[model samples]
Target chain A: MHAQDSSTGSLIAHTESPWRLFWQLLQRDRLAMAGLGILLALAVVALLGKATTEWLVIFDPTTVRLVDKFRAPLSEASALLPDADRPLTGVYLLGTDELGRDVFARMLQGSFVSMSIGFVAVGISIAVGVVLGGIAGYYGEVRIGPVTVDTLIMRFTDAMLCIPIFFLILVVVALLPASIYNIMIVIGLTRWMGISRFVRAEFLSLREQDFVLAARALGLPAYRIIFWHMMPNAMAPVLVTATIGVATAILTESALSFLGFGVQPPFATWGNILADGKNFIFDAPWLFFIPGFAIFVIVLAFNLLGEGMREALNPKLQRR
Target chain B: MSTAALLEVRDLAKHFALRRGLLGRPSGWIKAVDGVSFHVREGETLALVGESGCGKTTTGRAVLRLIEPSSGSVTFDGQELLKLNAGDLQRMRRDIQIVFQDPYSSLNPRMTVGNIVGEALRVHGIARGAELNERVAHILERVGLSPDFRHRYAHEFSGGQRQRVGIARALAMAPRFIVCDEAVSALDVSIQAQVINLLKDLQDEYRLAYLFITHDLNVVRHIAQRVAVMYLGRIVETAGTDELFDNPRHPYTRALLAANPLPDPSSPRPRALRGDVPSPLTPPPGCAFHPRCAEALAHCDRQTPTWIQIARRHGVACHLHQNTSRQGDDEIPDG
Candidate 1:
């Protein structure tokens, strides 16, 4: 068994045309590499970002220590730490907001929300879309509701596409109860139509592929043939789409929050922070600048990664 | 012919409703396999040879019940193929295996060769664990592959190797009647010969019957014990391999022989046929080949010729071959 495992590994090493080869080529791309490094670093920051809020001065964000209203950023910066009113130290580096709340702590905490929302929402959307779209394309007449729901689902997609996305989101948000979970659901559910369409087309082409037919002829179950045998080859486009989809979801979440239906008050969302800091743009530019810059950097990283994946997945680039 | 007919296809006709018109009324029909009939006795290679659009493939598919025939009976070991339900049909499919053309595309690139062959075994609950792996390795060896090749995927192997894997997959079930549906048509000439020779050896060793479908007359002559020549969805002639080549009664069969390019350049120039076949959708009213026939009489266009016994173990369907019954006196093989 040990010898067999070694031989198999070596055989794969010899013949494996795995995505790692393509990703290695992508790692050579300086801009993409930098972008990926920044993205990964940001992810780590998001995961660890909550720890910063826990350690520092985290008074309730809406708590009114009414005396310190409209205090300037640098001037009140020293006052808000666990160590009260000490001479300038490492504590409260970015300083206090008008509410005597540590803005830097809130900002750090806020990142967890942003990245989590972006990651989970996008992950959910991709999961739903890839499966739904794959089935739609791979097995065209597979049921979405009753009696070959393919035509109905497809038509619904067209109708949804025709409706302006912002307005559609507004209607959905209006009818639905307010919550971050609901926000994620709305974005994920709506976005899946594109993936389904893309996946469906991929499946249609792939189902006719010889390997898939070979799998069928081998008497493998339809589900196994569809998911296991066909999905890997058909999913290249969906992968690229999913990468870009993360950025889109993040941007959309930010927009919804800024428009006031998204992450509600008391939650330290970058969108809400950006919304709150909009009036004080000139007075305390750091508030808007920080969230704005974070969104920009993260979105750009995703775009870079997505573009890199597109190149990597391209069959034309597969051969030397 | 052997006593036990492993696969018997009688009066099989697969008609495709080509185009629906006028409130879903049948506008036309494509007689893909029209009244086609043949039988494969135990451990015998029965070749179905014809040109493109001749429905030889259709006959093979119809017999397998891959495409449901409009009207026919396919009896494999005395069981009606058409009467079987989905589960039974699926179960039956394991016994009647097929090796498709274009070996390059016949394998799933994602799967290793072991899985490709072992899939059938796994599906049918034949072997598992160390035993399964051992069986797969043994099967690979049986098809002239190294045991190490099992770990490798299809894309890693060449066309010939992939075909060997295909054969291994088919033989994994230990089937009785294997359908080679233009199995070697896509291979190089040398490779074709290798596969052909391998198939013959495998058949001999396993005592497996085969329905070898091909357009290549030379290959039919080489491997087939008996050959059925199809034309426009009908078997125009069938005879013992030597008898068909030596005395081809049907004109269509003669034209097919003439059209085949001779391997030897020094041989007499091969006689080429005139014009392409008519579409199956609007086939000629009576005898489908009458328009293309060189010796077509007025009556040939009006009436279809009956498929009759011309000689011992020989049959022909042609207006010209009516005198065949009287001309050649021999004991005709009773159906």
Candidate 2:
């Protein structure tokens, strides 16, 4: 009755689909807007940084300059000494790293790695999680032979969760050849438990609702019922989880790379850049500060975005 | 009523298994619908009336196989419904549909009104494209909704409008029989009349048969051609609407009639039945109604009553009705 009265009073139900309503709600929240703006800007920068590596930076990120090493930003390194080798690169924007690689260029290039790892890893996690979690959740109590599907999947998920995620990633990465794909897979494989549990909880309740019974009465096949009717209804929580999971995945990739087991050196991941900066923290703090700050901003943006999405998509929150 | 029954149910029972304790073993069963038998003739409305847990809703569902009946047979148009395979049953669903109890939860929230109504047509491959849209719009109008409302979601509609939409969805299937499961219970009194009139009009026009399930006896007096009163999952009495209203035979049926509120305060009023209904989990041993029956005897508590035909179209299950055959009475007219 309330939804009906309010629906006619406003154009919320008439003009907009739930998704569009969610967007409108998100747009109204300044924090969500800021989060969205940060992510968009970050995405643009990462893409532009990756695409224009040759034209924009001109200096190859991996190319080392021995004399330019440890140069403070915007300095003509040892120019007054007259015996110093002429700097090969232009003025270092954020200064050169410990290896004399252009910190700005490397950071820009590292964004590509960080962004891709975040997206691809999250995508992988979502794909695996949605399917596995969907099955686990939708068929939670259903049994196959001796094992209940929910019990089997959840038990396995619990076992996976028991292993500290980072340690699990380390063990897997240690076994497999360290590569971008490997890190993505390991992160994806280790991160689906929460999503599975969320989807299962949603399914447990949703499957009992009258609409689901109505769907069945309409004689819709089980697959269509689960995917079309139930999945969309269950997706609000999953979307929130995925949004937050993206940040977690990115952090994991960063940690893995910083520990020398992630995307190999010379690829210039933000993690390895931070790793490269760790040793030179006192001597050249810019190396540590630049990449460290980027990670902080990106992670914070995703978290805020996740929080906003949760509120916007939530009917209870958005109804007012 | 037509001689050809569109739907016939015989001893259809549904007992939901209840699990208890940690291991979740089957502890007991909820006898929601037990030995319910009835028929909905072509173009006839059979109202199955009962209290909340008496299983009128369950009977409606079992007839459609929405919830599979535990035991018994349902024959629709001479076809054994329970014996049909999945594909056959699905195809059979076209002939029989249900308008659910809650208008809010009946329609899928995510779907447009058009999709909700047109889905039956689309799924059955009965109509498509502009024809689908036209049929949906026409049915919408038939239910007193604007054709333009098809683009809107169910949440956009009032309870009355939503119930209309629910009716329209069932109507779209062009079904011969529909189980109106408390279809108008959630609406306002004024809206209830409008929906009832619409249902009446639709029935007259399309010759649609409806099994109107409800707890409202007053509504049954207006809509039902025949009434079946249920108590603890059993049909205690069934008769032509006028006969059941004027000369109710079963004690449970009398109790239900007594419970109906009379607007005229000056008339003598019968006291309502006392005590909450015994739980369906463990109904009283003999006749389920004996515990609450005012006319109960020692034999009523010891022996289950047989369903006896008291009149041409009236059936009553009670110990009082059983003695008449012994008296060699041709016409009791007991009331």
Which candidate number has the best DockQ?
2
Error of 2 at A276 (Å): 2.1
lDDT of 1 at A237: 82
Task: Give per-residue CA lDDT, model 2, range A93-173, as digits (tens).
Answer: 678877677777788788988988888887887787788878887777677766678878888888988988888788889
lDDT of 1 by residue, A1-320 (tens): 10211123333335454455567777767777787898889888766667654554333344444444444445543344444433234344455556655566567777888888887887887888777666566556455444345566567678777878877788899899868888888887778778878877777777766566556555667777876777877777887888888889888988998888888867787887787778788877777787888888899999998888888767677653
Which pairs clash in model 1? A133-A196, A137-A200
Q: Residues B1-335, candidate 1, lDDT per residue (tens digit)?
A: 47778988878999988554534456788888888778899899999998888898778767776567999888999999899987787778777888878776678766778888898788778898898999999878777777788877776766677788888888888888888989989877777777888888888988899999999988998899999989899888889999999898888999988878888888888777778888988889878889889888789998988777876688888888776474442222213
Q: Which whole-number lDDT from 0 to 100 does residue A58 have in model 2?
A: 51
lDDT of candidate 2 over B211-320, digit per residue (tens):
99999988999899999889999888888999999998888888888888888898778787989999999989889988888999888877888777777788877888
Q: After superposition, how far is residue B229 of candidate 2 from its true place, in Å?
A: 1.1
